[model samples]
Target: MSFATPSLIDAARSVLIVVDIQERLCPVMTDPRGVLFNGARLVRGARRLGVPVVVTEQYPKGLGPTMHDILSELGDGASSAVIEKTHFSAAAEPLVRQHLESLGRRQAVICGIEAHVCVTQTAIDLRAAGWEVFVVSDACSSRRPESLTAALTRFPAAGVVPVITEMVLFEWLADKNNDGFKDIMSLVR
Candidate 1:
């Protein structure tokens, strides 16, 4: 089947998935500074739109905790949930799936470390399971930029839509005159 060009994210129906942005993983990412900054801004914009947020830590026991930057922005509330998993794809973890179900979210705007592994797998699986998946290219990283490049190259074939942070925010806002338009535009700009 052919896929249509992805429309803007519907904040009311969308969620943001931050995958494996743990302390140890972040430091080793290809461009930690850029990844972390964009990831943080994504969280901020997602929060402002009142979209549900979920995070996954890959084997937190050995790798380390989710970095403070992400956690600080997500906070602790009904709007966000964090899960720990040994699986690269968060959707494969029972808790993560349950949390997503709890939010009743069908579309996931995803970002994080290790693009070819966790992020890619999650995008593929989530799409296979019938959720719309959008991979936030700029907010995801790996030890080699090649990995991110590869995922961006391959995921769309598996039904994962690749997007940048600004595209996501604007889609979620949809119009400059909407109530949240200015706030999301400020974040995007």
Candidate 2:
């Protein structure tokens, strides 16, 4: 995947990874509502597109659980694997690696909290592990805007693509005539 150009994120070869959108962490983020709303929407879109999802909660005991809205969107853990971890990067966890290997997908669409920490590290690590990473900017936040900016600035340099929620949805669809177009389009709008 060329960091200088747009890489095709084929749904057939993609997985949606949402990192640390936990209950306690949500309120402290710079764009709490935007992050959660877009993150939840991304989950719905991923399900609609038949893309596997891996959601991680960083120390759920301290962070509280994954937020209600996101958990509800993810459902009763029916389709997505919800992993718990202490590592800043979910990619560093054994379970996350297992999911990635089992899914056998090359592209990862990432959304979550604390852009400068867990989310950024996971994206970088995933890229290093030979996965094409796309970090959804609107769905990521930090307590300070500067931190988000700093991480985003390093994304392309690290070969991780920084994108938005809608881009992932549309790119995964890659066509309007497909069956889930309206459903995915509604989530983006």
Could you estimate the TM-score for every candidate?
Answer: 0.94, 0.95
Q: Evaluate residue 79 in candidate 2 and report its C-alpha lDDT on the 0 to 100 scale.
A: 57
lDDT of 2 by residue, 1-189 (tens): 454454788889999999999889999999999998999898988888788889898998999888987888876545588999888988999988887789878888999989999999999998887888999999999999999999999998888899998888888899979899999978866
The whole-model lDDT of each prediction reads 0.88, 0.88
Residue 124 of model 1 has an lDDT of: 89
Off by over 4 Å in 2: 1-6
Worst 10 residues of 2 by lDDT: 1-10
Q: What is the overall TM-score of model 2 with all chains considered together?
A: 0.95
Candidate 2 Cα lDDT to native: 0.88
What C-alpha lDDT does candidate 1 achieve relative to the native structure?
A: 0.88
